[model samples]
Target: MTHAPTPAAMATRKPARTAPAWDRHTWEEALLAATLPHHGARLLGWGLAHLAPTSGQFRAGTSRDAGYLGQALRLSAKQLHMGFSQLERAGLLARAGAAATDGPRHVLAQAFTLTLPSATAAARTESDG
Candidate 1:
C-alpha cells in the first residue's frame, strides 16, 4: 500500500534571510562590498597578519580578536567587519575559536591566519607610511 504524505513533510523550506532586499545581494556580499572597495582583499590580509601577533604566538583553535582596523590596514569599524567576512569566504581565513564579550560575543575571538598575497605585502609597506 502507498503511504500518504504527512503535513510536516509537505511544508516547503524557506529561503535564508538576506539584507533589506534593496538588491539581490546577501548580507555577506553586502558586508564585503561595503567594507572593502578598492582594497577589500588588501584590508583582509592585513587583519590576518595582525591577528597572529595579538593572539600571542598563534594558538590553534583560538579566535583572533581584532576590531575594524586590524594592524596597518586603515579601515572603518564597518569596513573591518566586512573585510573579515570576505576573508572567511576567500578561504584565506577561518574560524578557530570563540570568546565572550561584555555586550555580546562577536566572532572575533576565533583563531585565524592570513594567507599572504604578494601584492598585499607590497601594499602594506606602502600604506604603512
Candidate 2:
C-alpha cells in the first residue's frame, strides 16, 4: 500500500477543470428571430425575460392571454397568437391553459412556461457541433 501524498505535493498539482455554464440563450433567440416575423421574436424575448425558476421548470410571470399581451406589446391578438404557435412548435414555449379571471368570453389569453436548455443538454450540443 502507498501512503497519501504530502500537502506540499497536493498543492503543486493542478486544480480540476469544469465545463463552463450554459450561455446559448442569445444565440438560440437570434436563430429564431431570423425565422420569425410579425413581432414573434419580441414576444418570445418578453416571455424569456420574465421567466422565474420554479421546481424543475421556468414559469412565465405573465398569465395574461393573447389579447392583453397584444395590447401591452402593441401587436394584435391574432399576431400574438401566431407568435405563440410558432414558438410552441419550436419547443421554446409550452401553454398550460388560459388565465383564471372573470373576463370577456372572447378573450383567449394563455398561461405559458418557457423551456430553457439544460447545462447537460448544452454540453451535448457543444460536443455534437
TM-score of each: 0.38, 0.43
Cα lDDT tens digits for candidate 1, 1-129 = 999778777686566886332221232243343323337554555444544453223454344444433444655555556655555454445555432232212445445544322445335434542
Those runs of model 2 whose alpha carbons end farther than 4 Å from true positions after fitting are 1-34, 51-63, 97-110, 117-129
Q: Which ten residues in a row have the lowest lDDT in candidate 2?
A: 99-108
Candidate 1, superposed: residue stretches over 4 Å from native: 1-38, 50-72, 97-107, 115-129
Best by TM-score: 2
Q: Lowest-lDDT window of 10 residues in candidate 1? A: 21-30
Error of 2 at 25 (Å): 4.8
Model 1 quality (TM-score): 0.38
What digit string (tens of lDDT, one per residue) describes model 2 on residues 8-91?
999999988984443346535643543344455446446544433342134443455455556666766555556655545444
Candidate 2, clashing residue pairs?
65-109, 65-110, 66-109
Clashing pairs in 1: 62-111, 63-109, 63-110, 63-111, 64-110
User: Global lDDT for candidate 2?
Assistant: 0.50
